[model samples]
Target: MTAITKGAPRAFVLLRSRRRLDLLDPDPEAWTDEDLAGGLSRTMRWGGASQWEHPLSVAQHSLTVLAIREADGALTAGEGLRELLHDATEFMLGWDCITPLKAQLGEPFRALEARLQTAIDARYRLPRWTPEDYALHKRADRLAAASEAMHVVGWSRVEMRKTLGIAETPLVHDPLSPCAFAPWEPWPPRVAERLFLERFHALDHAHRSELRKLEPELRSSLVLTGAEHAAS
Candidate 1:
């Protein structure tokens, strides 16, 4: 989606689905998983300010968070799925700001994001965020941020914790080492899109009973296509 600024010439985005999404006032019906995946595959996180050659996309970051939650082994199947989709809204809406900048943007920015998130949650039949889920999400998000900071952005642990408000004790563990937390390298845009969709399907299959409750059209639309799976 194009940025919604006061005098920007382009005010709407035309998705591959031929749906025109209004930047200032997005219509939920105009969105689709295909559109989201494509957009997020291109949207850069940290406003594209990472040390890596390719900027970390929100889709990649989201998959890492779900992986962290799954590795933690405390959340249920539904909770794990929720973790995978916590940033789905960011997929449709362009990723433009970080946590600290969010405060500067104030309530308007937050309210808009929340509105998009609510629509996404309803479409997927995702349960409302319970207090526990919120806390866990925060922890997982911070853990990912710290990992990205230390590894991708090349920040020290002390700088990450002190500046980014990351948790002191790491929550995400290294898959290879099993003794430390490390960041996954940012994938190229195409790889990131495929992996994001692959993870989405994997989580959906693991939690189908919970996810199938969504509207049939939504459920079908959300499923990864044969081509996507093949590519991933």
Candidate 2:
């Protein structure tokens, strides 16, 4: 990885030589889909899960986000492209959970990640760190995170009060189903991949119209989520 200060700014570049993802290599011109599958498949190991979630993969969570977004309306091919790259850097930087990273790793990983992301952008011909994309993706990512915390992880308003030390009601309007944590909740690895493609094909062009617009009231409900699930 190399950093060139050609412009008046000091941007980073970590993956100067890495290959762009090939999920759609055979048909790079195919229809769009929600955030990247591989990115979400990212594991919760290395302190990735919050206390409420059951070690759900980022890929799974991304699917949920895509599903919810599709339920709203149609998104464009470009919007789908944007969503897919939202977490693309995870392929290289790995999912560094928020608290641990801010308190421990700090700026170094972020610096490298910024570089890797640049390479991803250049390779994919997508927009770079523009303010609009930043805001849009952050909203979806955070909303997805919060939804996973409250819905999938099984955290409660009381638990949130006791542990996270927040008096807020949490993003969930209700509690998790008893079956939510069942082993059956998570799909088998291969099935998960197939499901991602399935949903992508299913939602084709249905979510394009609302690409850049999201309801503030709706996303406001999602909050960060996680938990340490003890394997039985």
Candidate 3:
């Protein structure tokens, strides 16, 4: 099923939700959280190369990043959601290209990705990352990559540092071990999907609850501003 109408660009894919999403001009509402979770679960990282039977999935990797952040300290719902969805555009693209490959894909690919990400952010109402927060996020992400490289992708610690140029040490313990599938074992796509959806829903609910709590304060602030303008 195509979302593109007559005279529209033919750049769409039918989602598992039975909705069509245009790759070039994505609609935020076109896909559900379930769809995103499924897609991420199916999308493989490290170009689908893994030491385990199943390839490491973006879904699991996303959860790994979230776990790393949580291990550090408590996170606001918004921050947790942002970390979980960092590579969400990959789900829409259906490919998790490595860094060198992304460079080869160039600006057009990046622009499309940015557009899709904007749609996702709008759908989730994710908060904008402050510079400090973004820096910390990058650190956690890189640490996750380093650990995945060694544990799942079968790279040596030396290779991770010298070849992959990852400065962080690979983690000895699996961050997702609490999920209870297996330590350092890549999960089946279905399992990944289920886990991803579970986390997404949990974080999304907390985020919405946070928003609801702020609504009254927001309204009061708006009313105060209006009153000040009237006095002026």
Candidate 4:
């Protein structure tokens, strides 16, 4: 009849029901772009781990990746959405620490989770990822990782070696701290959803203008393929 978490309904997190008292749940629709921003700075270490910052979560990371791609001039609405939903699968599968992202969690798990992410995108009327989309997202993600690693994830290289008995690499600092530029605080999810939706329109217009700048065959191939779908 009902699922419970720590003697309450697990309305936010569906999978935590069995925990019986873990009321922790994340509101999906309430996930404003802020909640989904700035995750690219994360990493999948040899022993990958997941960490959250003050009012900032991994979901935040996804949004940042999208923003980076957009700033780089991804004019396509689908392209923008694709980057935002790159890790959409994690919402269903649970956030994996680096240990899991690597072999520890296994390939099947990642593949299945990835498929689910694609399905979620489709459900939301977002297109699937193309090769360039994946490459672009990964590049942003890696850069994000290096940035976050330096900002968060405590332990300097010397400390890591002395305490954990592990080798460490040097990472440059991000000029901005996690707190300086947050996407979520004052604005609610409704506002973020609206902003992104508007950007979808803007991106569509930009996409077309970009195509006209492409090579003749590249531009012509679009006309031959699903022009109507591509237009949007």
Cα misplacement distance, residue 132 of candidate 4 (Å):
2.8
Model 3 TM-score (2 dp): 0.93
Task: Between candidates 3 and 4, name the one with more favorable lDDT.
Answer: 3
TM-score of 2: 0.53
Q: List candidate 2 stretches off by more than 4 Å.
A: 1-42, 45-54, 71-73, 94-96, 128-133, 161-184, 197-232
Q: Residue-wise lDDT of candidate 4 within 1-232, one digit each (tens)? A: 2343476634343332322111233333433332222122221222333243232244445555666666667346556656656665554444535532456768765665555554555444555567876787777776655444444555465765675444434335332233434422222334333444454446545645554576597767777787777777
Which stretch of 10 consecutive residues in model 2 shows the poorest summed lDDT?
A: 23-32
Measured by TM-score, the strongest candidate is 3
Write model 2 residue lDDT over 120-169, tens digit each, in one string. Answer: 55545553546875665666666555555555565565775676544434
Q: Report lDDT per candidate.
A: 0.72, 0.48, 0.91, 0.47
Q: Of 1 and 2, which scores higher on lDDT?
A: 1
In model 2, what is the error at residue 42, expressed in angstroms?
4.9
Alpha-carbon error at 152 in model 2, in Å? 2.4
lDDT of 1 at 106: 99
Tens digit per residue, CA lDDT, model 1, 75-119:
656677788788887766677478788899999889878877777
Query: Of models 3 and 4, which has the larger TM-score?
Result: 3
Which predicted model would earn the best lDDT? 3
lDDT of 3 by residue, 61-134 (tens): 99999999898889999899999999999999898989988799999888988999999999999999999989
